[model samples]
Target: MVAPGLRRYPVTMRLLILIALLNLPIDVAAAEDRRVFFGTWGTAKQCAREPIKPGGTFLAEPYEIGDEWLRQGQLWCLLSWGPIEKRPDGYFSGAHARCGEDTVRQYFLGMVLSDGELTLRWGFPASSGPLRQCPRS
Candidate 1:
């Protein structure tokens, strides 16, 4: 009841399944490693002063790990869905799209230093200071 050329189909499928299973852990580990921005980030200084106050605190949650981006939210508002890239100087830079604003789609850049300081700049005013990482609940 089996074709001559199709006899190896089951074995081939099994081998493919096994290979995919073996790669699962590596994929998961990579995702875990990309979760560097997950958690609450806070700063006493204002990060924006143009359209609205950037607030004293912001949280970065895992959104699309495959895209290497986080869902950045401020107090009671979603700020940006942006990508955070690591620099060679141990600093992380992120360009985020400000949410709930004009159709102009202004992009803001934020840099987090090794000492937990964050520098954010957009259009007019900019903010920079030490940012404290909030304890996760």
Candidate 2:
């Protein structure tokens, strides 16, 4: 004979489970901007006050502030990375990050994917670590 108490126990558990599932999601949208730690393996710091510390993860704003490089006289050599939204045609549009009164935007060519790190690059990509996901709350 089945135990009388066991029958009620299963029903009670099911009722509690249903209530929790009905609550559903309560969080920020997926498109919301979030600050996260930007990870990189190799770095070039000839101009930065302190060279970007490698190995250990460093905190950065949600936006991507490309490396600042000024050419002697009148040349520009800058490198930056941002979220890439790939389209059906394989083309992508980068969300332009604004700073002060200027705009931070770049055209991405390709990304170097490895076991660790993702290097976002345009044209011929240089050797750099890949951009990993580190969403900070």
Top-TM-score candidate index: 1
Q: What is the C-alpha local distance difference test score of each model?
A: 0.48, 0.37
Q: Per model, how many backbone clashes are there?
A: 0, 4
Judged by whole-model lDDT over C-alpha atoms, candidate 1 comes out at 0.48
**Candidate achieving the largest lDDT:** 1
Model 2 worst lDDT run, 10 consecutive residues: 27-36
Can you list the residue pairs that collide in candidate 1? none
